[model samples]
Target chain A: MFALILPAVLVVAALLVGPMVLLARISLNQYSATQLMIEATTAQNYLNAVADPYYRGVMLTTLVMAFICTALTLALGFPAAYRLARMESRWKSLVTVLTLIPLLVGNVVRAAGWLGLLGNDGLINATLRGLGLTSEPLRLVYTPGAVAVGTIAVVLPYMILTLSSVIESIPRAVEEAAANLGASAFTVFRRVVWPLALPGTVAGCVLVFILCMNTYATAVLLGGSQFKMMAPAVYDQFSKGMNWPFGAALAFILLAATLVLTVLGTALLGRRYAR
Target chain B: MGQVRAGPGPDTVTREAVTRMRAAPLSPLAAPALAGPGLSVRLGRLAFLAAVFLAYAIVFAPIVMVVVTSFFDQEIVTFPPDGLTIRWYLNAWAQRDFARGFLTSLQIALAATAIGVPLGTAAALALVRATIPGRGFINTVLLAPLAVPAIVAGSALYMFYLRAEDWLDMDIKATLGGLVAANVLITIPWTVRLVTASLAGLDRAAEEAAANLGARPLTVFTRITLPMLRPGIVAAALFSFVASFENLELNLLLVGPGRTTLPVAMLSYLEFRMDPTLAAVATAQILMVTILMLVTDRFVKLSRIV
Candidate 1:
């Protein structure tokens, strides 16, 4: 067992904690492009992040967007997941295959697809124009909506795949018993199936939410020039802004939020089943 | 019965025609003939599925657009093209950067995989079997990078490199090795977690049986465990390749004046050119991915890769 798990532990230690520790240690100072402009033993970076409205707003909006997109993916994904659990394997295989194809394509590719679709001469606008729906093209690209759309596209597959596999593993006799006892399909679904499938669904949700919270590619391609999410904001600080300390501070805060959601998601999910 | 009559049958059909139609090929309208009171629901469902298929096409339109626009002979890409040509593909070929970038990417990805796969496989084995000190912390940390947006990881690495360059007496910032190290670190989680799950599902008794036969631990692991873990290993390799290749956020952070990966090049090209040539590049990428997927599916269980 130690043999099996030790390497994983060390790798994680190096990648996750080691870097985070390094970031936290660095966050206390004034690291710049030229050098670590060390103002040792100062909470100035954290203070600066908190006091700045622009940075705070970026954090808030990032949370709001992540939360909403996660919710939407869950909602949209649920029905398909339900269908996967309830349906026969032949149809399930086909639908499941279709759902997962997006995963093969990278985040940038999918985001770019949305960009092309939402562009001025793009499909959506062209269609709207062709139908005489609008005299002028609506600006749909490079907005929050596009970001959400792109994020959803990226996350939807994982949710469905994880949820369906979990849902499928559930004993059919349990669902069948509910149906056999004169429970409506809805009742069987709500009372019996959903409770059983919650573990996988919730797990998938939390995972995607964490992912959405940390997303960069989707936000960059779809949100375009002006819109800023935490990931991109963090990127800007490190690269364009060249303020590593601030970036580190902001990263720590974002991590805290993600950690909280992950805990709540897991605990709530586990306890729900426990009862 | 009502839906059957409402379907796209012969509007001018007579009773005699209805009899003859029964003998002909079953039309799409014949769906209602099979469904009962659930006919409306079934039709609605089929419509919804059709919508999903349409959305699938739309979701993948970038790839489609890229392919169509790449072969375009004319300079500008409009709806109807005047001619079709392989000019862009040749142009892409002409770009010396692609060859260099491709080779660099290939080298880095391969190097990362060679290092990452064993490390991940061994780590997965350890993770599944051991309940050591700081196990929870380790588990969390190992999987933590998945949560760390790649850009942040890249940034952190850049900072680390900048700060520690003198200490390590090494230059990693904007270096190929530096980039590879960062990517390998980020992608390690996926390979480890995936294999860990697969290993957990595998039976241990087989190993026990081998042990009972007095086989050495190394022999048992290599002959039995390695072969059993082949599928997961293949998947890990594919995913690592894809993750490494598709990486842009991290690459953006560390990409130097000269060391540009394909995606970085494409992003830069799109910024200035905004031409079908970028589309051509994108198409080439999509084609590579799609072909990879299909081949991966045929050989390895594609599910395992992700």
Candidate 2:
């Protein structure tokens, strides 16, 4: 067994655990523009991150946007997931393939797609003009809305896929029994289906939320420079600012926030389920 | 049946049609209330299905637009183009950076898949079949890469590489070798998950029977286990290759000069330009992934990929 697992352990230790430790070490070191990082250890980066209003604002925006995106994804994805779950037709596999195609497309490509549609002179605006909806094209790109829309598109497949399987696990007979008992469709859905699907809902939301929190390309491409989110900020610090220590500090903070929120959300959802 | 009577052959046919139609409404199994109890409910259902169709359209529109616009005869990516042509494809082909980047990405993806598959499969075997304590924790640790943001992983590995180079006096950072390592790290979880699932569902009685027949463990594994794992291995390798190929954040951070991958190259171009050439490149990527996925679907149900 040890022999079987040894290669995996080595790879994990060398790649993930080792790099994380090195990242933490770098986070504690002094930032140097020329040498990448100073040998001396300090908490200056963390201190600055905590003290700065800009970082705090960015953090808040990241949290708020992530929450909003999670809610949106859940709302938009649920119905489709229901369709996929209840479907018995041969079209199930076709729909499933359609759902996963976006995931297969890289983030850059997805962002590029959004650019095509969301740009001022893009398809939507051109259509609206052709239909005479407005005199001039409206600005949609590089806004918070664009970011949310793009991120939702990015994460919706995960939500749908998760909830479909979860809902599918529920026996159809249970629903049939409720219907046979003269329960309204709404009541059966509300009382029988909703409660049973809570765990999947929680899992899917948490996953999507964390993914939204860590999004970089979407924020950079869709949100643009005017909007600053956590992941892009971290990337900026490390790559553009040449501040590895500060970047690492910011990354750890995001990690902590993500973990804390996930746990808190899960606990809250668990309690709600019990109720 | 109660009021109408047949007079002749034509009247008899009309009576039969009426009887069949009347029987449909009487049969509860044939006509559920949800299908059309009231105009409001029917309209609501129609609206719901329309919304679902609209959602799917929204999801596919962007990807479809990229492919459609690639054939635009104009220079820019405008809708309702002047005409259809393959000029952008030719332009994309002529772009040397994209060609080189495509080759580089292919090389890296192939290398990463080659290294990650065996290690991941071995680990998965232990994870699925081996009797060990704390296997849950091992599973979590092994799959933790999925949760870690690629940007963070990239930054961490970039720092680690720099530090390691300082200590070992070897230049490995920003090289193809370094890329392979990072890509392998990110991709192993997927391989392990798919194979572990396949291995879990497998019947291991054949291997046990072989052992009972006095076959050596290695022979049993080679002849029995490996053959059983073929489908999973193929799927895992495909996934690993795609994951590595589609990766951008890590490549953006670790890619050296003249070593840009296709995604990285696309990102840089996107930062500067907005033309149908990008549409061409995206179409190429979509086509490649679609073909690969279709091939994999022949071997396994595509729905199980999630």
In every candidate, what fraction of the native interface contacts is reproduced? 0.25, 0.40
Model 2 stretches with alpha carbons more than 4 Å out: A33-36, B1-35
lDDT of 2 by residue, A184-224 (tens): 66667787777887788888998899999998888888887
- In model 1, which runs have C-alpha deviations exceeding 4 angstroms? A1-12, A31-36, A86-98, A131-133, A265-274, B1-35, B38-77, B80-84, B96-99, B129-137, B204-206, B298-300, B303-306
Interface RMSD of 1: 11.4
Local error of candidate 2 at B235, Å? 0.8
| Candidate 1 chain B worst ten-residue window by lDDT | B1-10
lDDT of 2 at B198: 70
State the lDDT at B135 in candidate 2. 95
DockQ of each: 0.22, 0.35
TM-scores for all candidates: the values are: 0.84, 0.92
Q: Return the clash pairs for model 2, or none.
A: none
On TM-score, the leading prediction is 2
**Residue-wise C-alpha lDDT for candidate 2, range B1-306, written one tens digit per residue:** 001111111234543464465423221111245344766655655665676666566667678878887888888777679999888888998999888889999999999999888889999998888789999988888888877888888889988888789899997776889888989886788888888767766898999999999999899999999998888889888877888899988767788787888998998888766678988999999998887876766666667646
Q: What's the C-alpha lDDT at position B273 in model 2?
A: 66
Top lDDT hit: 2
DockQ for model 1 equals: 0.22
Every model's Cα RMSD, please? Answer: 8.9, 8.9
CA RMSD (A), model 1: 8.9
